[model samples]
Target chain A: MDNPNLEDLLIACRQGSDDAFRKLFEQYHMRVMSTAYRMCGNIQEAEDVTQDVFLKAFKEIKKFREAASLFTWLYRITINLCIDKERKRQRRQKYHENVDVDSERITIEEANSNENTRTLDQQMWQDEIQSILQKALSRIKPKFRTVLVLKDIEGLSYEEAAQAVGCSQGTISSRLNRGRKELKTLLVKMGMGEEYFQER
Target chain B: MKHGFTQKNLSAYLDAELSPDKVQKIELHLQSCESCLRELQEIRSGKAVATCFENPDWQDTEALWQNIQRLNISTPEKGDVKNLEMKRTNLWQRLIHPRPAFAIAVLLILFGINLFSNLKQKKFQYQRVQLDQELSYGFDYGLYLDALVAGSPAIEFERRYESQQASYEQARSQTTFRLASFTHMPKTFQLREVRLLKNACCRSVQFSCLENSREVIIFQQPQGHPVTFGNYPLERIELNGQMYHRIKTGKWTVLSLQLKESQFMAIGEMNESDIAAIIFAITTI
Candidate 1:
């Protein structure tokens, strides 16, 4: 939707229009859900995060003030919810060893299995690369992972990422550099070594 | 040549985040250094691989939208907007333009007086069915509650106590949560007034109820405040899987429970059982 249409929808939403809210949700749910999914690496947690972000957005839309784009505001809420869910999951997992690696592998396979656009071989290779990348991304600290995901995966500019993450542009630059370097090391270790770099 | 540019600088260069001078230097160095060039290329490839995993666009939009709609979330209704605006402009106009606006002010005050009297009559009828006693409580209840709330750090209870009062319907309209989330109330005890007090320290929503001559006050604050309600004995109890603190001081019983992110406190001149029953009704619903 165009900017004017979004603004009109937002105003209607602020004035308590459920239809307007549903429209807004339709417009941004994909981006919000994907960000949450990528951040937490779990489909269930991502769904919960999306529900919370929209619920909160709908409740507090009047106070939104439009200081940032609606999507940026929504993304910030998604990131926060993902972090909170991760922390809660960690606490609940104090006694149990992590089984996410195998579970995530299955989830990724199941996710790709449904799509017919890619050839079987291509799908398998893509799933492998994605699973490895997600595992590596999960290993990185939340601060760095957040910046890297916003910048590279979400395709947010430095300024937009900074606003979404509630940090300065300088902080985003520094975190991106550190995050990219860490990711590079992890990818190399996952058998995507010098040859893979040359191929890309 | 100076030592090779650091990895962070190279990353910055790759992202185009560097100043022109630094960019020029980094480009000059990269032209001659195959090693650095390879590293940059590797970083780019890593970013590409990381960004490649697109979870198929969320296919369950209808299901999710249904879930959201079930929340009963909505902005303030038109009537609520009119009332809120009336309240704000009434106060400011009276203070700023009292003399020349006398005629209109008088008419408004007279209208308000008529409305309030009618509300009082309705309340009396409701309270007669609910409470046998006279409305024995006064602003002292407000003071006691304020004292209890004042124990929390950062709230200006004295200032808030006066400004927070509003009609029950107004409070219902403005509550942060849906009124249903607040749960059921005893039929005899009609909501007389509601107040929302907030500052940098805490946010509180107070609901005042009247039964005959007795008054009940309910307030909610975010959890984690160090709150004390005098030297009264506090008995910890659990009901409906929720924990509560029951404080009995002579004729007054106060029930405090923490739900989600908010701690709710209900106080009145009643027994522990009555207060507990009210707490249960409010919390579980």
Candidate 2:
């Protein structure tokens, strides 16, 4: 919001400047992709959500008021779209459980094979840790997960997270509290000891 | 300093979101209260762990932008925007300059419709209550089991099995139907708790499993006594000559399948892959 170049780009985007839109996408796509990835817990789904978010922002660029920053607006869209995607995935799962059963089985087998092929080196260890953390995060309730992703992972301020989630700061604080506790319990259960999280 | 800081306060403290005065008070309290200090450490550790989650590399910006542009081929023309603005203005003008007679007529019609709909709704409610009373042992029973798994305080019953084996043994002794034991489970899940569900007409045993931190409940009842989830559209799938029914309620997925004389319902917020794996584990076992 404070960037004059961003403001000019926004103006140009509103005036149907594709170049300006491209610039804006390049600036914020990584942020959006990261947020979506953490929220969805799957890289493919995150990519899909990122695409949808940009498409939605482009389509509704004319209606974007300057009351909120472009980042916050795009974030709100990303969260809403991620949530929608989650719901649709749940619904789709109900019907296509068997149809994709074999593919999922193969994915699990491939993951196991990949783990075996990769040496237990530092990078593999890091990837394992990241995978465990993601699994724990995916187990959390969506409301709590979103807050954690936006505030903790994405490094959004309390005010910014509240604006993006369309909630009061108090709600965000409470959700963050619960989310952190749940994540800790999950991490501990997933073999990440409490001491691992503690500072040296 | 009468009590330790609330979780919200401690959480905010970790994020440096507290006011100067509040931060000073918490710091003062943290020195004296080991319990509060530990809680603060745990919260900080949790935040640190969360911060360690790095964003994955996403190098598809150009491709994604191009896809967006391709999908947005029908961009609104300048004339279209002007027409939309004109229409919005006209709508505002009409709202500002309403005819009193037309407004009164429309209000009267709306009032009449509201009255008629209210009457109809009352009749429908009466019938629904009657239907619910009849299906209380069926539809409401499933919800009661769900509530129990969710740990709803509204339930007056306080019966829980001491262990999984005890639960299975008790259920086997009490019910005439065959109890299906999950000899095999998905690798990611572990059996956590078990509870017995009993009412006037039917009996069931609820097995709760923990997949990571999420709770998955599997309910087993006699085949003839089906747990009906009222008004929720269920998707039916046929696999290996057995029919399975599934439905999504919010984030939770309810999947029920019949095996011989036992009816099994598994409810959890699991992906399709996990659900399929669970189904395979159950069916194969």
Candidate 3:
């Protein structure tokens, strides 16, 4: 019974108790790393982000309260950090985007081309039915994408998902519904809708 | 049940949260709609698969719990050790070589400030007169940064060209519901002032087309390189009736705007975040 849940670990970390912080980190490290990995597209960036999140959590653990779960607080920090990292990366890519005058790399032609399709199929779609699912996943806006990842992909309940993404339950439900619809449409577009999955 | 139910209704039905009538309707809708049926199946499959991943040996993550030992780990600033080493060497030398070295360091710091202010004045002064006329106002950096850092005066604004303007006391306040229409300048920029210059006189907004934008200029002074886009003079556009325009004038780019309502000049020399608060204070007069 004493095996600390998220709340316990947060309380422990707050008291400057290393054991409590360690327990919380241990329980959530993989989840946090995996979450970051999925949120961003790279494993290395996720690992770095994991370390940064822990370091920040350690420093700011004093601010942790019972209002939200420890994991939710961790997620807010992680998402913010990852977004910031993406912005910095864009700063580095300024030279590249600046050179291209015609398009921002996503031209209608490029979007429909076989090369991009193959790339999308190969990269986003890992297995057979998974590809169509991925196209659907890709169609969701960034705001909704995080919600789906947390809820369906990560299997967090509605409340946990809301706290993690910093939104209300109603918002989470709406986003999840909209995301589900978009994902379904994406699957249909990929020609792997009901007919394809009907066999499975 | 033509459009039987949304994915939301399906899930609610599955979760048993839907009313009986809603469930009956959804069930009828699902019976006929092939697409919704497929999506429901796919979600069930994904959910089952997602469950199999049951936190994957999070129990054995005990090894990672060792990182918790680092909770007490004194996080050091990246520069601390190097600075310490430099200080150690300086301390040893202080014991050996004393007076002139200390005097020289002080002299260097004073000289550094003088050199910095001189360069700042010279660089800004060179552009001041042309900028002043173009901006339709006198140039004063100190007065401007302070007004932005505190808050802009609660002035009544009456702009002939402004379609809309939203002002906030602090930059962070601007990011809430007010700017949901468009992205506000990030609060990290630490804004010093927010002023909406008239299209008749405010400096050119290089990359924005938002007519009559709530311009949030950060108060960060410039460091390192100045923005240089070759010889292209900035292009200014007065937004149409109610669109917003975002413009940045950092040390590298000096944007001076002359408008009918007010003389609006954006002097860029600092990082964007340092002046975010001031930028948020901007409102239509």
Model 3 stretches with alpha carbons more than 4 Å out: A1-8, A87-140, A184-200, B1-8, B14-25, B28-285
- Candidate 1: regions farther than 4 A off: A94-121, A193-200, B1-9, B28-42, B73-285
Tell me the lDDT of model 3 at B276: 32
* lDDT score, candidate 2, position A102: 44
Higher-TM-score candidate of 2 and 3:
2
Measured against the true structure, the TM-scores of the candidates, in listed sequence, are 0.49, 0.51, 0.42
The local distance difference test score of each candidate is: 0.63, 0.67, 0.49
lDDT of 1 at B4: 51
Q: A25 in model 3: Cα distance from truth in Å?
A: 1.0
Query: Which of the two candidates, 2 or 3, achieves a greater DockQ against the reference?
Result: 2
Model 2 lDDT per residue over B213-262, tens place = 45455555544567766566789987656789988756667788888876
Top model by lDDT, which number? 2
Sort all candidates by lDDT, best to worst.
2, 1, 3
The pairs that clash in candidate 2 are none
Q: Write the per-residue lDDT of candidate 1 for residues B160-235, one digit (tens) a residue.
A: 4446553323333553321212222444343343333222222333333334324455555434442456556679
Backbone clashes, candidate 2: 0
For candidate 3, report its TM-score.
0.42
